[model samples]
Target: MSDIEIRPARFESPEVQKVVAEALADLSQRYGGSGDDTPVTMSDFDPPDGAFFVAVRDGTLVGSGGWRRHGSDAELKRMFTTPAARGLGVARRMLATIEESARVAGCGRMILETGYLQPEAIALYESAGYRRIADFGHYAGEDGVRSYARDL
Candidate 1:
């Protein structure tokens, strides 16, 4: 595989929007309804409070993810990799970059929510040292929702 470059990105940029849409579609197909109903804003991923990242390989966007400030912790969001980019380490690279960015921003831990339908995502987080935690965010207490956290 060619080198995958992870870079900071604006959550609302056209490229990012396209990637987000793809992620939503995938989620919808997996768990039904208009995908994730969690509310998010561009400012949530802006600097000083949060950071977003995109993974590119050979000049094409392959994956994206971001982290938002949650007290002393960072909340991961919008994590996804293009279907064609799967098994190429695009998602893994993007995840590492996002985690480091949050740690550098003074976050002492990272948290995230994923659905039970996403076994791949669960595996990734678990392999990276994340462990199950109390439910959180919009899907808290909802069936099929799983939350995880890791100390930075």
Candidate 2:
């Protein structure tokens, strides 16, 4: 994992878009849909208000995630690790990076929305100390959707 480097990235950068497309493809396969329908914009991941990141291993982008201000809390978004990087702690490192950045930006907590179809993601969040929280976001009240939160 020492070869993996996590760093801030522009949401619109080509490398970030590549990883995001891969992630959405994975989600589309998992849910048999066009992928997540939540609205997002490049400015949502801009610094000061929020931050986006990528995990690069040997110069290849292996993972991506970001956090955006949601009131006093930071909402985690787009966390994903390529199949080839699964179990390599790439997502974990990215999660830690996002959390720290949100904290430094004055967020009091971190929150996220995921689906039950993603057991690996649920496990990761639970193990990272995230607890079930009231449903929020576009997926709120939707079947199979789950939300979690952790104090920063």
Candidate 3:
């Protein structure tokens, strides 16, 4: 594999949006339903309060994820790695970056919501020290939605 670089990026950039769309589409199919597409926006990830990140390898966007303030914690959102880059540690790198950035911003913890259909994601978070937590935001009480949190 080529050198993979992860960096803060605008969520609205065309490349990011394209990957987001692809990720959601795959998730929707995996979950047996379509997604509503009504979540956070670019401004929600506009630094200090939040941030978005993308992983690029040899000029191709291979992974993406971001974090936003939710009450006193940083909420991870939009995490995804293209199928072609799934086992290259891209998602794990993006996750670590988000956590480090949140810590710098004084966030004591990081939280995220992923569906039961995404066992790989759950495994990644668990291996990284995240533990089960009560759901928050739109995921609260939503069947099949799994929530996890980790102290930063």
Q: What is the TM-score of each candidate against the true structure?
A: 0.97, 0.98, 0.94
For 44-146, candidate 2 gives per-residue lDDT tens digits of 9997989999999989999999999999999999999999999999989999999999999999999999999999999999999999999999999999999
**Best of the two (1, 3) by lDDT:** 1
Which has the higher TM-score value, candidate number 2 or candidate number 3? 2
Candidate lDDT (C-alpha), each: 0.93, 0.95, 0.89
> Which has the higher lDDT value, candidate number 2 or candidate number 3?
2
lDDT of 1 at 99: 89
Look at candidate 1 and give me any clashing residue pairs.
none
Q: Judged by lDDT against the true structure, how good is candidate 3?
A: 0.89
lDDT pick, better of 1 and 2: 2
- Candidate 2 — which residues are off by over 4 angstroms? none
